[model samples]
Target: MSTLEPIQVGLSNALLAPERPLPPGVITWNGSDPSVRFDVYRNNVVVSLTTALAEGFPVTRALVGERFFAAMARCFIADHLPSSPILSDYGDALPDFIAAFPPAQGLSYLPDLARLERARVQAYHAADAPALTAQDLACQLANPQRLSAARLALHPACIVLVSEHAIVSLWAAHQGQGRIEDVDLRRAESALVLRDGDAVLVLPLSLEIGHFLVALAAGAPLGEAAEIAAAAGPDVDLTQAIVLLIHYGGIAAWHTPGDL
Candidate 1:
């Protein structure tokens, strides 16, 4: 196989990058003014890509007016080409791009907000797992010391996010314009995103809970994560966070680390 064939194949399928013209023998259309025919395809290509981008970053579009949104979309398309056929996965680089975009500078938390949105979408597709309930925990918590060293299992859809700005407010505000008058944008926040059955929920997390989840995600034992959470923030309530984790999908089950 020649290198040019693979290049042609890639260009044909890639929706986000510039369309490379095919070799002379690759097409059936023969016309003196071929550019006109090609223009139709080019327009379709641009529309398809722009539409996907707009769907992915509607918040970004809302923040930056429509004209600038199209311009930024063009830049984003040129810089990072689509690596997959799935349009939903197209804008993973958008948050990073927004951080560097000059006009978007005023929205300092835009990147984190984008991250939160992406996590919500990804969490929606995460594999399903049976969640632990209070009844299940009542039986499992019987061996209190054993539970400490055991590896805690987080649900497949559980995700934790940490932000330095009020991204949670940004996300909630975008949910509707009603509470827009009451929200103060200066507050800092963090959140946990998880799936319960078919619904995806983004619940607010206290700073201690966020740190505890991060520690658990880092493979810290339950006892160690609680300790780390305490060391970082003295007010951390292990019992409460643990209960919520089990309640929300942050935790699915407990197991002795080496048990077969």
Candidate 2:
């Protein structure tokens, strides 16, 4: 390491920690005390990151209220700094952090809500691809044997989230779609998040459809994925699932054994 490496490390360590004394070698133009300046910079950095977290997880913040969310965000920031310069790329670990956070333990659904919001952020920034049209999918899966063995490539923005809590309803409720009081916190829900044009949509899915989509996303063939969904729920409607995918432009491409 160079001579400045320790200085850089010290500055980085103290940037998010208000309790730490100012790192050495930090000087202002006036040659006055660096402590006050350093403190201001630290507050700006923490507040900027906290704001990013709030924007990324609006529903999560609304659930806990601003003050509580800010406190939790400060705690999260002290440990989890940005790995990438992109503001949207930050807070991927917030869901896991909330799961382990002591004060947030009472709201068991908050973690999954964070996860759902994080997925929305990721979906918004994911790469774009041309989705397959209904006719295209129909043509590709015309043959029964080929259909059984066919593999699908989902859109890059496609994401599936399954949670034991009513994350989909909770998130939608905050968006003015429904009443928060009407939502049953204990109910399990799954969501399919996909970017259509410029809008990111969060569509509710049945438990069986969630399993099917999860299996498909993992590269399972159609027949095998359908079987998994059936195992999860006996009344798995493969046709309905396929229709949903086609309607939402979730299927990017399809490949048969020969193409594979």
Candidate 3:
């Protein structure tokens, strides 16, 4: 390792940890105390990271209030620093952190809410692809045997999030689609998040549809995916699921064994 490797590590560590003393070799141009200067830089770093977290998980932050969220974010930041320079990718682990956070234990849904927000961010930044149109699907899946064996390639932005809490309703309520008071926190909800053009949309899905989409996204054949959906709920509507996918531009491609 280079001689400066330890110094780099020390500076990186001290930047996130306010309790640590200024790393050696850090100095100002003039002969002034580096402690105050270092502290200011450290504060800015933490504040910037905390702001990123807030921006990424606005719903989560709102649920906890600004002061509580700031404290929690600092705790998280001290333990987990950015692995990438991209600020948007910084808090992928925040959902898990919120799950284990002592003060946030009472808000069981907060973690999943954070996860939903994270998925939205990911969907927004995901690579663009031409969505498979209804006409394309119809022409490709015309044969019954081929249709049964067909595997779907979902849009790169597609994400299925199944939560035990009403995350969709809660998130929508915050977006002014519904009243928060009307939402039943105990009810479960599933969300299908994907990008359509420049907009990221979150649509509610039935438990069975969620399973079907999960199966399809995992490269399962259509027949098998329908079976999995049926197992999740009675009389699973395979047609409705396919229609939803087509309508939302969720299907990016489809292939049968013959096509391969």
Best by lDDT: 2
Clashing residue pairs in candidate 1 are none
Count backbone clashes in candidate 2.
Answer: 0
Report every candidate's CA lDDT: 0.75, 0.90, 0.89
- The residue-by-residue lDDT of candidate 1 on 239-260, one tens digit each, is 7877778777566666776566
TM-scores, all models, native as reference:
0.81, 0.93, 0.92
Q: How many steric clashes between backbone atoms does each model show?
A: 0, 0, 0
> What are the clashing pairs of model 3?
none
- By TM-score, the better pick of 1 and 3 is 3
Model 1 residue 130 CA deviation in Å: 1.9
RMSD of candidate 3 to true structure, Å = 2.0
Lowest-sum lDDT 10-residue window in model 3: 137-146
Q: On a 0 to 100 scale, what is the lDDT of residue 26 in model 1?
A: 36
Residue-level lDDT for 36 in candidate 2: 78
- The C-alpha stretches of model 1 lying farther than 4 A from their native spots are 1-32, 177-183, 232-234
